[model samples]
Target: MSDYKLGLDYALDQDRKDELKSYRNQFHIPKDKQGDAWIYMTGNSLGLQPKQTKAYVNQELNDWANLGVEGHFEAKNPWLAYHEFLTESMAKVVGAKPIEVVVMNTLTANLHFMMVSFYKPTKTRYKILIESDAFPSDKYAVESQLRHHGFDDKEGVVLWKPRPGEELLNYDDLETILETQGDEIALIMIGGVNYYTGQYFDLKRITQLGHKQGCNVGFDCAHGAGNVALNLHDSGADFAVWCTYKYLNSGPGSLAGCFVHERHAYRKDLNRFTGWWSHNKQTRFNMRGEFDQLPGAEGWQLSNPPILSMAAIKASLDLFNEVGMDKLINKSKKLTGYFEYLLKQLGEDTIRIITPKRSEERGCQLSIQVKNADKSLHNKLTEVGIISDWREPDVIRCAPVPLYNSFEDVYRLVEKLKGILK
Candidate 1:
């Protein structure tokens, strides 16, 4: 990584040597009016569509057209057990056992559902803890959960904030908060990778800390799945939820994934809201049978999933299974390291990266804090051909997604950013 040189030829050379270089052709890269590809750096927000997604979706459509209701059992993938098809591949993506993972519901809905089983509150231990600047939606969900349980939302919530003027969170700060307020906290919910700062937290450390306090722990891995090695099973969290739209490359508003540790899989004593889909598959068709909840994460499903959306996920996951996380993460470090190298060359006085400098502490996204710059700077980048996310006031969140983004793409992005900064 230190050998990265500043020139177009260097980028071309890196791309040529990249083992995963051919993956870029699998996606449908966006183009301008002149047919030039945009420097897309917003996979943190929404990933580019896979070229194979259309064919996968079309297969489901064709099955639906021919089989109709019978497609539930007769279709090639079979809608009756369709979500089951996604369980194994997705578990691999998140580093969990096949029994612990399930694909169902959208992101926030899955978060809410996971809360139903994990967020057990009482008169004294009623507090819920989260990061200070959690994604706005997660903040809203936790606050609403507090209100729903008849506690004062403000008093029931605890925020683990960063030190003054600092952007990234320190684990020491999190530990300090738990030490002081551990007794009062019933649940600890945090973003696996902070959306704004792109800080990938230590899931295992947080889970161990929460468990030591007798608090249930969970993660909203909306930004971690398919982007980083979450190792959810090893983290030993009570539960987790993540969307497939971002790094997983499922379409917008696609179904999300949920994980329940194997220890809790057969624990029928745990309280949860259930539906017919949560019942045992053998008795699912028989209305007379009482609710015998299916074991593991599948026990959380409420209804049969959408086949088309699952098909898109299947398409992306098939590719993931082929390449594996080890290979993707290896290339990701080099591409992102090269990007950070180029950004630093712009000068620390001008460009300030708020994300952690260490590769293990972050995924591909870098939150660049451009001094004195505003939204217009982002607009200018967009006008030229860069697709990135602009947070309120100052940060530009750029993710050089390893699956589709090339070393040349990262080089061009930094070059364009340099022009804008100048």
Candidate 2:
């Protein structure tokens, strides 16, 4: 509604005014056969690679070629401390303290590792709670945890479901669930932003509510990490995990991040799986001393990290550190707001936006429900060089990442949809 117009000129004018417009040049936007750039809107899935990523990765390759074993300590960045290079910038991107964050493992692997420490369920309080529509990987991880703990997976899982016919979750319903069965639930693991609806939950509220009921709370922030202001430390959640391949733009299946609140930084009593990398660095080469677990989130590490993968992460984090989340989020709100405005102009009867209307309650992605449409609609969109993601029955998830996407990309997307629907 901010006096948005339905024309290419308006989008071009907005792009011209965008300070982040220069960033689009940093990425190599995919091109179709005719050499035109495809309107890439799936940053929420796998982010586009930064043009600098190859050079960053090549530096590690060259260091490895020049120095084999000595590269561990002699390389420019030093392989022995590669993960440390990303800690500060990664912490800043997620609004966490340096002691609270570490980059290691894939998303699901970090979830299980975190669960080994956090999901300590007594027989009386063995049930786990999660959104009914959580990503399949998370559901599988939680269910496996229940089975490993000698509990009935089916009976031990409690779902915070949306009301009949609705897509978004209701907080009141979650309160009612906790009020009645809070003591029986040992862990409340939820996606920070529901991937299907693009609805960002109030992490602090959920944490406080779960704590009042004597339950441990954590989040799978795969969808919320770089796209929204998570402020994981301020939320006081027990732990959180997310992948770097999404908004972090660190390539596919790159290292994921784990956040262990400062309160749990030094707790030796926590039951966690550990490996050689978790030992004190100074004594690590001794290979003969007692196991001294490092303090803070790094204590959870199980293996030496891959420098090539960490190189991609370092490349992406450098950009994030330069831009800062405050400015990125400011542009995200406006870009997504513009996408929503254009979709609303398509008429409610023709399509519906399942993502929360308030900019603060969602991120860059908008989940659109086209009336009576099937996956063929998504197929049609793809056929025309628009790259958007399609959820099972009908939702087309489009994310106009402020770092690379432009207002004109969004404008062209709507025009393509209109033509197909007509």
Candidate 3:
């Protein structure tokens, strides 16, 4: 691959040689009213729709129309085991065993479910720890969980914060928190990827540290799911939850995925909120039967999932399976490296990347903190059709997804920033 450390030409050349270049056509790239491409750099916010999504979704629609109640079994994809259709491929995407991964409720909802099971707090160890900049949903979920568990949030929800004047979080700070509050902390749940900064934390390290403190550990991998190799199985975290909308490219607000380590699978004695869907499949139809929880992550399901939504997830996972995450992440390293190089060439005095400079610590997203501009500049960029997202306060978050975004897109985005600055 030719390295594009300078301008658009190098980016163009890299795209020419890209093995995954042809797959871009499989997505429904958004277009302006004039039918031009919308410069979609917000894959970190929402991944583009796979062209196959419509067909996949339509398959279920047709089954529903034709089979009626029979669609639960007689259809091509049986609704009874619909979520099962996604397990193998999705297991690959998030690096979990088929037994541990299940696509069910939305992200925040799944986080609450996982917390209910794993965050079993005693009187002394009732505290929970999270990053100060976690997504608002995560913050609220943990706070509510503490209150639900009869712990005062003020006394129970601990913040693992960055040092003053720092943008990126340091692992040392986490260590300090665990050291100081280890005895009191019952759970440690951090975002695998920081939503705004695009920083990918070391899940394995975090898990080990939390376990060292005898705290149950978990992660919200909403940003890390398809963007990085989570290896949740190896990380040994108690549980994890993630969404498919972003790097997973399943569609906006699609169903979320949850992982409950196999270690916890056979523990039927553990507490959980269950329903018909979580019961043994064979006996599920036997009304008035006692709840016999299914094994592994599938046991966590409380209700029948939306088949249409599962179809969309199946479509995206199929694409991920074909290209493979290993190959995709390799390209991501090179592509994001090129973006970082070009941004630095523009000089750090006027702009700075809040995301970590180390390639291993992030995915394709680059959070640029502008020198003096605010949302007005974001509006200007939007006017010119540079479609990146602006988070609160400062930082324009742009993600060049290697799956659908070409190196040329990153080049164009950088050029637009240069033009606006000039």
lDDT of 2 by residue, 174-208 (tens): 99999999999999999999999999999999999
User: Model 3, 29-63: lDDT tens per residue?
Assistant: 88878887978989888999999999999999999
Per-residue lDDT tens digits of candidate 1, residues 232-253? 9999999999999999999898
- How many Å off is the CA of 278 in candidate 2? 1.1
- State which candidate has the highest lDDT: 2
Q: Judged by lDDT against the true structure, how good is candidate 3?
A: 0.90
TM-score of each: 0.99, 0.99, 0.98
Q: Which ten residues in a row have the lowest lDDT in candidate 3?
A: 1-10
Where model 2 places Cα greater than 4 Å from the true spot, the runs are none
Stretch of 10 with least lDDT, candidate 1: 1-10
Q: TM-score of model 1 relative to the true fold?
A: 0.99
